[model samples]
Target: MGTNTRRALTVAAWIVVVAIGVMLSIQRFRDAVGSDIGTDLRTFVAAAEHIRNGRSPYTEFGYVYSPLVAWLLLPFPDFDAAVGPWTAASIAALWGAVAAVTATFWRALSWWQRPVLAGVGIVTALYSALLSLDLWLGQTDTFLPLVAALAVFFASRNRQIASGVSLAFGAIIKSWPVGLGLWMFRRGVQQRGRLIAATVGTGAAFLLLALVIHGPQMFSEWIDRTLVLSEQDLVAYSVWGAGRHLFTQSAALEPLFVAPIVGTIVSWTLAAFIVALIVITLRRPGDDALSMWNIATAVVLLIPVCHLWYFVLALPLLWTWVAHALKGTRRLESLIAVAVMAVWWVIVFRLPPLDNQFGESTPQYIAVVGSSLVALTLSVVLSARRDADRAVVVREAVPA
Candidate 1:
């Protein structure tokens, strides 16, 4: 087939995939809307309602999210009366933001590559199991991907101010997107004055909104609420969490404070990984912005406390990477990408949560070990490959 014909077919296929995925997501969301699920969404809504009633969302309610996220939730009603519509609306808005950012990034790609990139994005977004879990729990993980996508898109376009604002907004909502700010700084994008302006502007906007919604006292309460939540035992339920949990659960474990030890180890590991990635990207200035972002997002996703919804943050970058990688016929990496998507779907949909019941089984151990190994292995392999590629490019660019 001619290249154009192949591209057309690819585009048609992606459209179908995206349509089907949307239908499935809607069906799952409908089934889950009225069910009592996910604590984060409920907490956010409650806090919002408190503020709307002329009470401090921070002082009157126990909410852990940033004031801006709570403020955004304040407009929506609680789950009691309009659960279905409210849940659906939130999902729709989150997905719409994802779609918009994806489209903006797509426009930056070459015509022939856009379709392939869209296909990868659809695959990542639809990864039925992940979306199912997010919908079933009414989780806000979807926002992570949307926010990360916006940050990346703006940063790639040299809109540093907008990127900083997006990063700040995401951080306020979930606290993970602050990693993006670090990533930006490592990339030397932090030197742009607009980035500082954007960060300050976004912070001021959040403070202003908080004051308007809940009076000045909300600031102190917000800090207190966050501190209380942080001290709680919401330790790792993620892959990294699994290891920490196991170590803590062991009878022979030391009294060195398992959570903090694990946390510190993970923090240092992530810092080293980021430094290496930044150095590699710096050496290969010819590499695309999306590629660098993909590596950064992947590293962040592999962090111990990262939840399933965190995968959403990696989708945009993944789409960009897969599109370019596949264009050059990198079949093995493409297959790995497919496998990663499958793993996410399985975890999001099939893996049943162990509710601290006493019955231990070999199958449970197998499931946990197998999943962690897969995630960890993929993370290592991908990071190594990117580093190696950068090294090769640097070597070839030098005089013989």
Candidate 2:
């Protein structure tokens, strides 16, 4: 494609993405108001109200979030009035994240690649099923993923403290971004020491503040609620969760008679294994960018709940990879990777063919499990190879 033609096509694609986003937003808004059912934003507002009224959110409505989240919401004028505005605000903030990440990619590209690649990358990311689900559900996980993205962007620019603080804030709100922090630790001994100190110090301060505001009992209650929630029936869209649904639904697997809770156990086991793998990869030096992308992917894949919104954590990483592919010889491989991912995400998260209960159909199950496994394996291999290549370059640079 000619440069001008590609740029024009990318622009047209972005227009389509925007139109789709607007349509989804209108439908979601109608659903939110008409159904009288509360989304996560409403839950968050209710929890904030409890905190404002000097009650425990955990005791009131089983709010699983850390106390810091409730405290953060205290400044909102009225809890009931805050939901729509906060949802809108989150959407706006998510756009900012898209811009930040796009700019990050632009910075890494040649001038000729910037306009076309930026438009294509941002449009591809924003149009994903994961992001569409995120906006429609009023999921506050948007902010955390945005923070994690900003952390990577800052770290890439050598802003250690800023990066640490951003990742630490996300970790304080939600635990997934801790993986990003660990990836940054892979930079080197000196940088890791600085990053760890800043992250730990910031996180410790936040916890102490929460402890002072809400007593030790509140901490105990929060911990209990989180643990209880984790052990709930696995409705999660994660690898093992989807596999469990598939297995339970499969008539062929019926003879095996797998226990329902077995899936939950397996998901947690996989989560631990993924965590170990990422940590080990980070501990060894590699391309910092590659490490960040791999760590983000690993964290999202291993998260027990793995809600659709949570997958937004992978947006920056995915788009960056896409840009690299568009500019590289392996464009076909990247296209296949992305197309498979979009299909898996749509089936597993956006449009599950089966009901909440099990069913006869197993296509969604097979698609989700197969695509997830393939993507995860591909990510690990690519990251390891990039790291090895970087190591070879460093070795060759030194005097022989």
Candidate 3:
């Protein structure tokens, strides 16, 4: 067959795949409406309404997000009433936008890989339960990955302020992306001060604006609500948190019996480990893509509590590995990534009998967290071995 014909066939196949995925995704969105759809967005919209009424969202609505988020949604006053339908449409539009952006980046690839990459991205966005929940809840989690992507893309072009703004906005929405901001700063020692300044300045501007809208009292109420939520026995997708679930039958897993200090110690220990992973990855020679992947995976693993949608943070990292696979750089890693992502999709979407029927959550939590931890561990170990081998080669090459 001619190359042109083969390319045409590949594109046609991708079109079919994407068309099917979109139809299925829309059905899922339709099912989600009037049934716990846009729960988080509803909370935000409710908070906005509270704010508009000269009431504190933190006190009135138990809103955990920073006050700035409510203000951001002020333009959409009708969000509360129509969050479900609006979010469904938004999710579809965002997936299309993501596919188009991903395609632009892969323009150098062969025609087949371009559509395949785009089709894969679209399918994952549309079909995965993580993203389904993200859209259904009208969650900001979907937007964070885009923010991280833009940060990396802009940093690649040496657009420091734009990158900083993206990262800062993400961090303001949720604290985790501050790690990404710091990663960008570490990439350029000379640019370090300006990067930090820009990130901090951006965050502060929003925070101050929020405070002005509310009052000094809002800070205390926000902190109280945050602390209350933290103490809740939320089933998180972290190694430590999953351990809490897996061993719930055992007395050792009972937080009530354990000292509060013990819990705090475990949290800090995991955090330190994450910091080590970030440092190891940062010291290695690689492009911004690899750095973003390393930092994002580490951050996700270390988050104290994580929902299904929180895993979206790793999407860009997975995409980077997929790109490497397309280039035949590391097919093994890519295969592992594909396998892990498949397992994750199954766990999140619950594929019928694989459901978390019991509240214990061993099946789903272990599957998702275990697969991610294994992939991350392999990446770190391989990177260390590669660096060690290079060091030995350098030593042997020195004049004797």
TM-score of 2: 0.79
Count of steric clashes across candidates, in order? 0, 0, 1
Listed in order, each prediction's TM-score against the native is: 0.73, 0.79, 0.79
Q: Predicted candidate 2: what Cα RMSD to the true structure?
A: 4.6
What lDDT tens digits, residue by residue, belong to model 3 across residues 191-257? Answer: 6566677778998998788788788898888878877776445566665665454544332222333
Ranking by lDDT: 3, 2, 1
Note the residue pairs that clash in candidate 2. none
* Model 1 spans with C-alpha error above 4 angstroms: 1-11, 34-38, 93-113, 188-191, 238-243, 250-308, 315-317, 329-350, 353-400
Give me the candidate number with maximum lDDT. 3
Task: Find the number of clashing residue pairs for candidate 1.
Answer: 0
Could you tell me how far off, in angstroms, the CA of residue 279 lies in candidate 2 after the best superposition?
5.0
TM-score of 1: 0.73
Clashing pairs in 1: none
Task: List residue ranges in candidate 3 displaced over 4 A.
Answer: 1-21, 34-37, 75-80, 89-97, 100-104, 186-194, 248-272, 348-360, 381-400
lDDT of 2 by residue, 320-390 (tens): 56666655634666566566555545555455333323333456545655566566556556656556666
